[model samples]
Target: MPVESLPLFPLHAVLLPGAALGLRVFEPRYLDLVRECGRAGHGFGVCLIIDGEEVGAVASAAAFGTEAVIEDFNTGDDGLLTLQVRGRRRFHVHKVRVRDNGLQVADVSWCEADPVEPLQPEHGLLATLLHEVIDKVGGEHSKAPESHFDDAAWVGWRLAEMLPLENAQRQVLLQTGDPHQRLQQVLALLPE
Candidate 1:
């Protein structure tokens, strides 16, 4: 598999494919990263912080992550940048390098896209619950027009976004390339 070098942003949260995340930018390294991404018309990788904090110290990040593209940008009254990023694809980190400013650069391989399969009848409840959760979230965070609740890959990705799973659990789901397997894992974790 071919590997690509990507700038990494380790956070306390997991970014799933097809989900949107809003971040407040203040750290100088991150600010520069955002600018570079914008200038290059590219995205950065967001990995779950396995150890350490988002500030100061160089943190250990999960090997699996999603590439996030900037969807919108705004400047807060406090002079901080508020960015809205939409998750694109999953990647596996092979190597990492930390810059002097604490930014992590990763050598990553993109995961193959899962084949789409219609939602199984037994999983109807999961689709219903996902719609409810999206409704509760409201606004642009709600389901997209192309959202296919009937498709297994779509359902799994949406559930990964809405379910109240730990960041680690969500990371696992993101790393799962098989949609049906991902959904099965999620179903097993859901309340009886």
Candidate 2:
């Protein structure tokens, strides 16, 4: 498969497919990255920071990450850019290079989409919980017309996002391509 190059944004958070993430952009390199992505109508890659800080120096990032597209953009009173991004696809980094300005560019291969499966009866509680959370959040973050609650992949993704899992745990979940297996992992971590 041919590798696609992406601009990487390594942070302490994990972004799962179908989830939304909010970011405050201040650094010059990131501001340029956001602008370029917006101009080209392309999404950027987001990986969990394994070491170092989000600002200053190049941080170590997880191999697997998700592609994030800008959904909303605003300039804050402090002259920083506030962005709402939605996760679209999962990718695995094959190689990485840091630019002079501290931006990381990665050659990545996209992960295969999980096979569709209906939500099992045992996962009813998870669906209910997700529905309640979405209701509270509202707007585009809310449940879609197709009703993802019945989809095993969607249910697992939503649970993985809402769960109080560590960044490493969330990265594991994001890398997992099997919806059923992901749900089983989430179930194991869920409280009674």
Candidate 3:
């Protein structure tokens, strides 16, 4: 469905619906954006500008990202805001409508999920290796399951965004329309 024009905040991170992301609002423009949302009962988009000269300088120029809703917010002594947001949905940005007083507005469209081929048996190896990586990282809630690999989209989004991959690689994953393709790209990142 077509979404109303919304403010955009393109970052290097990807946040899925129901996922929690902490944001430190320091930039004047972004602080204004947050305040506007708080007043308007609306949320902003957090997109990553994969191919842009200036990120956060303006809104419309930012790349695709997920819709996010503020969960908790507090203004600090420095006049900065410490806020937590929950991602709501994925959306494609069309254009920026406003950029003033440290705030930006943009036209956006919601993106639908693309179908993907079922994970093949060999994909289990990729899952196993990822489990090891998670174990190495430690402190995460739990290890990746050793078996039962399925649902390419959930796996792809979860792993692509969660893995310690660089922003460029994560951008590639976000750009792809196919879930299996995203999973395959991430699998390629593993050692042979």
Candidate 4:
């Protein structure tokens, strides 16, 4: 896999592959990130902040993250930059450095993407639960492709994002490589 240097956006939230994230950009550094990404037609990485705040200083972030591709953008009434982004792929941060402008840039290796695997019969519980969760949310996922509940990776990511799991737990699920294994991890976390 190729190692690429990517600008990191550390947030208090976790974004799994195929999940959606909304970010408000008021910091100049992140504003620069949006501009740079727009100009290059590139995406940035979103990692969970393990320490420090999202503003002023660079925060310590988890090594695993999802590449956030900008899907839409608009200026809020307050004049802040609002971004609608979707998680593309997962990456492992090998090393990180602080730029002069305080942006935390990481040299990351892209993880192999999940192969298409239909949901297993044993994992059908996850698919049904996922359907209930999305219905309760009133279908706010138009931006996400029509839910492919039969797809193992799709089912796992949708649940990972909707489940009331802690950021650390969510990060662990994101790092799981095999789609079926990831579904098993999610099942283990469910209440009996």
Strongest candidate by lDDT = 4
Clashing pairs in 1: none
Q: Please report how far candidate 4 places residue 15 from its true position, in Å.
A: 1.1
State which candidate has the highest TM-score: 4
Model 2 quality (TM-score): 0.92
TM-scores, in order shown? 0.93, 0.92, 0.75, 0.94
Locate the minimum summed-lDDT window of 10 residues in model 2: 137-146
lDDT of 2 by residue, 19-98 (tens): 88999999988998998998899999999999989999999999999999999999988988999999999999999999
Ranking by TM-score: 4, 1, 2, 3
- Candidate 1 per-residue lDDT, tens place, 30-107, comes to 998998899999999999999999888889999999999999999989989999999998999999998887789999
Model 2 CA lDDT for position 110: 95
Task: Give candidate 2 regions above 4 Å deviation.
Answer: 132-142
Q: How many backbone clashes does candidate 3 have?
A: 2
**Cα shift from native, residue 33, model 1 (Å):** 0.7
Q: What is the lDDT for 123 in model 1? A: 86
